[model samples]
Target chain A: MAQEFIQWLSHPGLNHFLIISGILFSFGIFAVLTRRNAILVLMGIELILNAANINFIAFSRYGTGTLDGQVIAIFVIILAAAEAAIALAIVLNIYQNFNTVNVDELNQLRD
Target chain B: MDLFTIVFYFLAIITLGAGAVVVFSRNIIHAAFALLFAFFGVAGLYVLLMADFIAITQLMIYVGGILVLVLFGVMLTSQVLDVQMKSGTIQTFPAVLVVSALAGTLVGIFWSTPWKTTAAAPMEVTAAKIGEMLLTSYLLPFEIASVVLLAALIGAALIARREKNA
Candidate 1:
């Protein structure tokens, strides 16, 4: 079993990409859930986007020999760029109003 | 053992390690900088997957554009290097528990699923095909994405601009 696992590791395949993307996605979730900084949360979202991109490219390369995945990945990248721009602008607005980027401290909407 | 596998593992480690730093780093500036490496590693992975156009796009757009904007935001904001630079976490235990469970499930699924695999082909130029598809089959989404980007640009400017009454 140990030798088989090592051999699997040595051959980087579709499953390898999938596993890596899964880990990245989980880390992104953890960051979004736990981090108090709004910017950090945005970073987490980027990570998640990247994880999805990896999956798309991997499947396109290993499963289907087409350019559809690459095209979609380009669109995803563009969307991620736009999202980061809007999110950073919003975060800056929040800082201007509340003087802090900590999500926990932005409880003014609370009763 | 092989060079291809070696490069892939190296890039993966860099990506994941930098990603971890981006998540758990206390200093926001450090995290922002660490994100640079993560993006680079991801781009490298894209190249290894034979998506050269996507890889270059990832490097240029992400490393050149978005990351610089993020760094600028960090620098322009008030007290970025002071005590407030420390990014704290809330409900760490519960978050870890949930994330770990989700990760386990995903890994199990990946291992069990019999994915469709084809013989590895030599890297070919994909820019032309991608461009052709964008203009033909994906024309609607392509145009919509541009519209969305325009809206985001205007929205960002509107929101970040200083109010006159203030």
Candidate 2:
């Protein structure tokens, strides 16, 4: 039993990572849906991005034939930083105009 | 299970649980804390994947920098006490429905696909190789991303600094 389990552990496949990424992605979507704060929404978005990053790095590590996945992960990180900067700016602007970052109150477009 | 598997499972559980709390918590500060845990978990995952450089970057950037920024935003904007913040109504039913559907679709796609490892020979490359690629073949995109960050910083400063005497 020990030997069998050890062999399974060293399989070097991406399935475990994929499953974890999928769960993280789901949790992120849940956060995006239920959270009322704009900043929390941005956190959710970051979680989603991190999930994608995990997938990229996993594929890069396991497949290793091409560097494309690792390259993509680098781009993803840069894009995520850019995204966070713009998002925070927008959040700040929203707070300035309304003095609140609660999503439910921004209902001018809800008619 | 070996050490790697043990660590992977532990980190994975922490990440998923913390992520759930991030969405489910009513107080924004608590949510931010949970997000920090989730980010730390991802960095752990990076270590498991043997991307030590990327793992360190994830820890520094996501947990240290971005999360701090988020917590600052939360503190700057909120007036309620922690107890008051804890009672805010988060719309539930619609959110649950949408999230469940999304999870189902994603898991379905993941399960249906037979993920085959590409038959290409493994490259014995390092983070140095990646750095070289970024500077050479990927230089154009790298430069563009830097420009975008510069623009974002300027824009953020411009939008955030209100005219005080106006």
Candidate 3:
């Protein structure tokens, strides 16, 4: 059974990519949930995006051999860039105002 | 088993291990830098998967562009070292429990589902094909993406700029 598992590991396939993506997605979720710092949370979000992209590319390559998944992955990358820019800017503003970037502490609705 | 499989395993380990550091590291700077390797591993995997265009894009945009931006965010916000740099986790038990459950379900689904897969995509220069698709079938989204990028650029600048009235 152990040798069979190793054999399975060596033969890379759709399921392998999916499992890795799943693990990465879980890591992102853990970061998003646990980290008090907004930047760390953003990093987790980036991980999640990467995980999703892996799935897309994997499906694109393995499933239909279509370029649509690759195209959509490109779009997703663009969106992630925009999101990072905007989110970091907001985090900076939050830091400037509150003197801290701890996400939970920035929870009050208004001044 | 083969050279390809070996490379895939190496890339997967780098991706997941670096990703773990990014998520679980106590130091925010460590997390930020660890993200660089995670991005690099993903790019390598894209290459292995024959998505050459996406792999290069991942390297250029993710490694060159976004990672730099994230590092800048880290440098600008955190002062000096040690005290403010520590990124502590909150509600650890719940996070672990929830994440483990989610991951287990995803893995179960991925393995159990008999995916419809053809032979691996023929290794080809995908940049030209992707470009043609972008211009033809994906034209609307292509144009809209540019617009969205413009808006984001302006918005980010507006938000991050020093407040003169303060």
Best by TM-score: 3
List the pairs of residues colliding in candidate 2. none
Q: List the residue pairs that clash in candidate 1.
A: none
**Taking the tens digit of each residue's C-alpha lDDT, what string does model 1 give over A33-66?**
9998888888899999999999999999998978
Give residue B148's error in model 1 in angstroms. Answer: 0.7
Each prediction's TM-score versus the true structure: 0.96, 0.87, 0.97
lDDT accuracy of residue B39 in candidate 3: 97
Residue lDDT tens for model 1, B1-166: 8899999999999999999999888888889999999999999999999999999999999999999888877776648456776777999999989999999999999877999899878889989989999999999999999999999999999988867356
Model 1 TM? 0.96
Candidate 3, residues A40-104, lDDT tens digits: the string is 99999999999999999999999989989999999999999999999999989888888788888
DockQ of each: 0.79, 0.49, 0.87
Model 1 DockQ class: medium
**lDDT for position A94 in model 2:** 75
> Model 2: per-residue lDDT, tens digit, B1-166?
5676778888888999898888778767788899989989899888777777787878877877788778778776777553445525376788788878888887677655777766634335357877888899999988998898899788877767755334
- Candidate 2 - chain A - TM: 0.84
What lDDT would each prediction earn against the true structure? 0.90, 0.78, 0.93
Give the poorly placed runs of model 2, Cα more than 4 Å off: A1-12, A108-111, B80-83, B87-90, B118-125, B164-166
Most accurate candidate by DockQ: 3
lDDT by residue (tens digit), candidate 3, B1-166: 7899989999999999999999888998899999999999999999988999999999999999999999998988888554767877899999899999999999999988999899985689999999999999999999999999999999999989969356
Best by the lDDT measure: 3
Full-model lDDT, candidate 2: 0.78
Cα lDDT for residue B14, candidate 2? 92
